[model samples]
Structures are given as C-alpha cells and as structure tokens.
Target: MTTTVIAGKYVLGMREGRQALLQDHYVYVDGTRIEAVTRDAPAAGQAVIRYEQGLVMPGFVNLHAHCLRGGLFRGIPDDLEMDPWVPKLVYHILLPLTGIAAKELTPGELHAVTALGMIDLLRGGTTTLVDMWHHGQEMFFDVAKEVGLRTVGAPFIMSASNSRLGEDGNPVWDYGNDGLAQLAKSVALFKARDEGHAGLAQVAIGPHATDTCLPELLRECRRAADDLGCLLTTHFAQTPQELALLRSRYGMSASEYARDTGLLGRNVILAHAGCSTDEDLKVLADTGTHVANCAFGFAREGQNFPYARFARAGVSTGIGTDSHGMDLIGELRVTGLLSKQFFHQAHTGTAHELMRAAT
Candidate 1:
C-alpha cells in the first residue's frame, strides 16, 4: 500500500558490481520490495525523493560486525598485534559485563546501545550486518527488528572455560562437555521467536576465535550449523603469533585445523586472514569460502593482508570495516592502494578490481 521513488545521479549494487546512471530517474518501492527502477515515475507511488548527488545504491552489507563491543569497547587499544596474547589482553582489560552483570540491566540500556550501533551503521549505508557480541544479544535483535535493518545476531560462544587449551589437547570447560549449551539454547530461542518476525533478523553462530575454541567444540558447532541450515563465522589466522601457537600445539596451520574440525565451506566466513599461507589459501579457494578483509584496521596494527595472494587464489574477498566506522568506501579504496603497494605492481589491484570486490 506504500510507494516511493529514489532518484540519484548513479545507482550501484556492491554485490553485483553494477551501476545504473541516469540524469533523471525514479525507483518505486512497494512496501519493502523494490517494485521498479525507471528514468521516469510510474505515477503510482505516494512519495518521490529526488537525490541531487551521491550515488543511490543498495545499502552496503558488513559481513562481520560486533555491535556490543563496538560501542562499549571503542577507542580501547590493548595491543592487538601480539596474536594469541592480544585476545587474552582484550578480554581481561575490557571485561565489560556478562552473566551476572547482564541481569542487572533493566532492558533500556541494552536497547539504547543496540540502537546506537545500528544507527551508526545505517547512517553509513550499511543495511545489513552480522554482529557477534557476548552481551545483550536479545536487545540487539529487538532493536534491529524495530529499525528495519537486516541483522544476524551471533552470540560469542566458547568451549574453553579457562580461555586456553591445556597441554593434553583437552578444553578447560565441562571436560569437553557442551560448554556452550546455554548459548545454543539462547540461539534456538531467538531463532524460533524472531527469525522471520520483522524481515530483519537471522540467527548465526560465531565460535569467537581459534585460540578460544577447541577442536571438538569447533566440530560440534559446525555440525550444529549444518543441521540447522544456518551460517557459521569465525576468526581465523589473525596474527603471526597466533599462527605460531597453533603450529606449536597441533603442528598445523589454523586454516587446516579449522577444516579438519569441519569448519570450512561456502557457509563459513572468516575474518582477518592475515596469517594464512599459500596452502591455506588453496584450501580456502577450494572450499568456496568467503573472507572479510579488514585491511585498514590491520594496516593500523602494522599487519597487511595478502590481498594479491588471496585474489590470485580466486577467493571471494569482501570488504569489512570491523569496528573502525570509517565506512566501506574508504576501506575499499585503502585496500586497493595497499595491495598495489604491497605487490609493487601497478596493475595488481586496480580501483575497478577493488570496486568489483566491494560490490
């Protein structure tokens, strides 16, 4: 029963890498679905918004975003380049709130933070985001539903109680029992209650990071995701120090380790694959895996991803802002520039290549 028109000089689709340029155009939206995109109005819509400048395109999608930690832990630098230690440092230094602390909130603060994070993303033209945060996931879901943004709520789950594995390859939680049983139930409840409620919410599972999830836990999570027919995301090969730890513990790369535990495939998305090797890249390409390149954030930490290597390997690379909030456009531009410099080849990662990746 509702209709509108959005006219801009150019319209682009980041996913499809296509742009429709028009001196004068109109887009008619029937309820939520875009009904028609034409140079002239159909004379049926209720509202017509004419944008003089700025590209009108489908909003960007941030594949890996952390809403709760983004706002609560912003501007706190805990020396992230140290690999395995960085995670421990971040968790200990920024011990925000969880378990007992979560119960203390009256639901208002949770809603506020959720709205605040989504508002920032929406303003940046991010229509959809996959968020992994340990606290206030329910409130986050509610806010996304209300705001009409597509959101995937992934609660941080782990099987290692002590946050690190022991020398015997045994996880510290439940003696390898279901350490994330509560988290699993929470995910199921949220899915059952809100999966299709507002056309804005989907349930996903994030295994935190490799250093935090043991082999058994990762396998179990993968099986669970497969059975439920959902998406699975994880942090893999984030730093050299982390890679060293994995090598010491299992004598294998983190990518191989994840694959061994059944965590690599089309449905699985990895973030910050800075430490991946050539063999790891082959596995990723063969598995049809998707990667979110946080090149700019890593650039700040003095770590540059192997963008040329990844592109050569035929891996589908998507751009992500992480928690930097600089917008995808800037990230995309920086990625292209960095790749060109890293490879020392002018034609390696051109602007059009980066634009195609972003789109």
Candidate 2:
C-alpha cells in the first residue's frame, strides 16, 4: 500500500458528481483501487506531489473509439454521403495501409502504432478506452495492458451482409471466416486475458453493426454477453439506409427490432443511433439503455444528431469520438454548437449539459 498527496486546482469524480477545487487532497492506493479520497492533506511525514494550474480527476472513460483506424485514417476528410465515399476511403486509404494488418505488422510495428494511439489518448487524459480494431484481440490487449490504461476491447463481428465494401474490394464477412467455433475462440481469449497491470481491462461482445449481423448471430451474441456478465455493443441506426433496411427486413424500427429480439436492456450500448424515431427514443429511455453518439464525426459526414428528440425522450446520452479523433473537449464543444444550430434554439445545449455528456 502506498499513500500520496496531490494539490490540484480541480478534482472531479463522475460517480457522485464530487468536485474539489483549489485544494490539497490525500489519496491512499492499496494496489489498484483508491482506498480513500479525502479533502484533507496528508500528515507531515507523508510525501506530496503538487501541481500548479493542473486538474486532477478520475480518468476519462471513452465509451466508443476505434484505436487503430483512428491513427490510420485520421486527417482524411469524409464526404457527407456514405454511398461512394465510404467505399473509396476504405479501399484507397485503409486497405492500402499494411500497418493495420495484424499479420502484416511485426510485433514492433504493431506495438508502435498502438502506442501512438495510446500515447495520444493518455496525453488527452483519457484513462479508459473502449476500442474496436481489425487486429487480433491478444495483440491489442497486450499493448493496452503495457500502456497502463483500462481497456474494453471487442472483436469486430459481422455476418450475412454483402453490402459493405471492404478495403480489398471484397465483402466483409461475419466474425469468423471458419464458423461459430472461431467466434467462441475470440470470446474465450477476451474472457481469459483482458485484465492487465492497470486493472482497467474489460471484455465486451461487439457485433459490427445491425445491418451486417444476421438475427440468429445477434441473438447468440446477446446471450453470450449475458452469460459472461459483460457489455454488448453494436452500431445501430447509423444511417437512413441502415434504418430502412432493418425496418424492411424486421417489420419495425431498429430500436423496436432490438426490443423484440430481446436485445434492448441494460448492459447493451448502441452507437450512432442517429436515425432512431421518437417512439424508438421512448423505448430506449424506458429500458435504461445507453446511446453513445459520435456527434462530431457523424455530423462531419452530414448525419444529423436528433438531440432534441433524445433529450425529450429522456434517454441517457453519452458522447463518443467514433474513431475520427479522441478529443473529448472538441466533441463536447461541437455537441453544444450542433444542438443550437439543429433546433434553431440558442438555449438547446447548455454548457453544463454538454459537460455532463462528455465527462
């Protein structure tokens, strides 16, 4: 056990909305978890690390981020439309980058790239990151552990969707090229070694998106998360095309489809739920489900965020970078601006509300 004192200008805890301003605090750490957080300074015999003009806060939790893609595809502007731009971007940019290939990059190269992303995240004060990548689970997990950050990694799963264009000009298939056994192996590996030195590793079942997954496979993933007592996350209602496809196939909206399929509950997080309707928002509100919106990136691609509907529906909304960039401040700032522009109301998204979403 070790004890230290830090004098900080601001110490914010999201748990109870606790804030300590311009004060000296004592933190007792018995290994990982903080044993105690006190306003009082440590005794005269104790050591102290004081900061000037610095903020000491619990690590930022990034609800949604793709670590590798963010580094590889950053700075390329995306067209608002997804029809041809998405495909072109993938094949022309991402697919050509050998660095992203799990088998292509040597241990050193992979570590370096992963480190690049990790360092940027840490510098920005993000302590927890939920990442989806194209590499092997073990490799990313190992690198994340070495960086001393909390991680939630998911194997990117896809199924039965031939519409999406991969970088190699081929259809992106489901989780495993072999079969269900491969899916089992991925889930097992994540369950086996997700924990690391920082005590911040967690495993979640990640299906790529609703359009890519078959109903049976999605159901299986939901069951697996429940059995493992972990989180189940997927992309849903990201675009109008996806919404139309799900409705046509399932005879209901995407959120409604999830509800009917028994996937609309706690521990399930749907990312980029921009196309959800008013009714769909109500269901999400009642179910205690969470929506992580990448408002900055999605809007950069011309997708409008239905914040008014979501707020009116009483849905608990969180902000994400969605692999574009992990600038929490930028995301929060953009969210506030977008809300005012979208609703034609200057008072739509207040600073306090935006801060709550980002923090």
Candidate 3:
C-alpha cells in the first residue's frame, strides 16, 4: 500500500505542547494515522496531493450537538418569540419539537433529515461530534456510518423524557421518567452498534440534564460510563429553572450535584454551564470536568455563554454547535466575537484558543 501525502502551503502542526503554524509542510498518512509532519519529502513511491494555497489542519470536534434537530429547525427559529411559560428555548422548543418530529416523521423522512444534518457537519469540517438526541438514535447511527463522520452517539436518558403542556401553560411531566431504564437502552445501543464498528462510531452515557434526571439516576449513569469505559455527558446549568430545581430538590447547585453524584471528573463533558456560579466554576475546575460551550445557540435565545469565564476558571473547555447553526467555524467566529464583546476583553476567546477548543 502506498502512503497518501498531503503537501500543503501551510499546516497547523503541533510543537512543544502548543499549536505551531508550519509553512510548506508534508503530512504523510498511512491509512488513517498521520505518519509524520515534516518538511522533508517521502522516500520513493507515494501518492502526493499538493495544494499551493491550502491550509491543512486537524478536523474540528463538535463536543456537544443535536444534529438532526439542527437540520429540522435551521431557518425557522432565528427570531422566535419566547412565551412566558416557555422561558427555556431548548426545553420548550428544540427538544420537544425534535421529539415530536421523531414520532411523526416516517422512517424515510427521518433518514433524509438525519443525513442532511450529518452532511452539514461534514461540510462544516467537523470530522467528529457528540450527537445527543432523545429518540430514534439508530437513525443517527446509520447516518453517521453513511456520511463517515466519527460520531459519539449519546442517547439522551431523561428521567422525564415524556412531558405535556398543561392548561396553565406549564409542563406536566409523567411519573414514568425512569433514568436507569433510559440508560440501559443507551448501553444496549452501544453494545449493538458501537461495539465492533471500525472506529467510526462510539457511544456515550448521557443523562439529559440534572433537573430532568433524578439523583439516583445520575449516580447510575456515572457507574454505567465507568463500567463501559465511555465518556459521560449531560446538560448542566443551562437555565435558571434548572439551577433552581436542583437547588430546591437537592439543596445543591448543578455542579455540586454532579460532584456529589461522582459524575464530575476528567471523563465527563457537561454542556452549557451558562448559569453557573463562581462555586460551580470552581467545582468544574477542581474536578477536571470538560465543558462543551455552545455560544451560538445561546446567542439566538438572547443569552451569552461566557466561555471566557470558564476558560479563566481553569475549567477544561471545548466547543459545540448545539441545536441550530451547526457550522462550527461560525460557532467559533461568532462565539469569539460575542465573548470579547460580552466580557469586555479583546483577548477573550482568541482565535488560537478557540481553534484549539474546537479541535
């Protein structure tokens, strides 16, 4: 087998544990692994693809996302008005609508939507992403394989996956929201699809959100992730309602609940953290829990996801596109500008650090 050499004008290579932009570099690829990144030419017979104006770099990793939903609501909710009862855009609009789509759309319709979403990810240069959706994750798996994007399918295990709007315009959740049961289904999906796949797809333990899941269920999710040796991810500190709920029920913040349940760790990737307090940031920093910051979606809902705060707090931070606008480049560019503006610091969310977080 001959090696495929990507010789480019500029390559964003690595040096001394930091990003180094190397000019006139040749990156040798032996199958999937990058064999070398150097200025010297490869010895003898090899396939060479030279690009005089190309800038080669590692593909972006969207740390938290809902690809299908992003496709579904792409152009619809840009200027949506928020109802009084439905204060949270994601809970009231995104997830509920996506769930409805899952039940209403035919399998073929679902396939097309999922494929479009995955294709969008590829077009955006996202070679890998963590897709978190509630139902019909098998459609997600199939689309990931077909499109060839490395996916970590995190089936959302909500303690109350089912809910309905009451007459008073409040969510009336059924009591059948079993977190352990939902988790088992996710694990089964892991064993079935992600077990022997050729590294293109894997699974993660996702317990929806702290407010949506009970304490016992969150604890079980940690154990399940540990037992399976997979990553654990969930929504954290996204809304004021969520924070209030956690504080009311457990008398602890979302970060503290996560820490108490043993879910706060290096293997954990918590999405959002928009409403996190200083103590919560401290918990995130001390536990080494990674934060998947998706500021684009938050901006659409008239909220700023202070990524600079998380970065300054020494929390491990990564980027995600979240529900709509799956363009990760736009995610970084827009989020960086928003961060600098919101935090009143030009140095906040620098291009170098933002690119690093995305990767």
The best candidate by TM-score is 3
Q: Please state the error at residue 203 of candidate 2 in Å.
A: 1.4
TM-score of each: 0.82, 0.84, 0.93
Better of 1 and 2 by TM-score: 2
| Predicted candidate 2 versus true structure: per-residue lDDT over 1-359, tens digit per residue | 67556656665443366333434555555556767667776777787676766777666667788776666567765653455323344334543453245667677877777777777787787777877764353577778878876788877665631234556444355434432443575588666865633456777788767766667778888888888778888887766656776777788888777876556788987886888888888889899888887788767766568455576679878777776776776777788788888888878877666656655
Ranking by TM-score: 3, 2, 1
CA lDDT scores, all candidates in order: 0.69, 0.68, 0.83
Candidate 3 residue spans exceeding 4 A from truth: 83-86, 164-172, 195-198
Lowest-sum lDDT 10-residue window in model 1: 92-101
The regions of model 1 sitting more than 4 angstroms off are 1-3, 13-22, 30-36, 44-46, 78-106, 161-178, 194-198, 306-308, 345-352
**Local error of candidate 2 at 128, Å?**
0.5
**lDDT for residue 284 in candidate 1, whole number 0-100:** 89
The true-versus-predicted C-alpha distance at residue 68 of model 3, in Å, is 0.4
What's model 2's lDDT at 174?
43
Q: Per-residue error at 268 for model 3, in Å?
A: 0.9
**Clashes per model (N, Cα, C within 3 A):** 2, 2, 1
Candidate 3 per-residue lDDT, tens place, 1-359, comes to: 56789988999989898999999999988887899999998778766898889888999999999888877888777888884325446656666788889889898988898888888889888999898987455878877888888999899887777754456443445678766778889888888877433588888999877766777888899999999888999988887766776787779877778888877999899999888898899989998999999998878778888678799899999999888877898899988998899888899899999988888
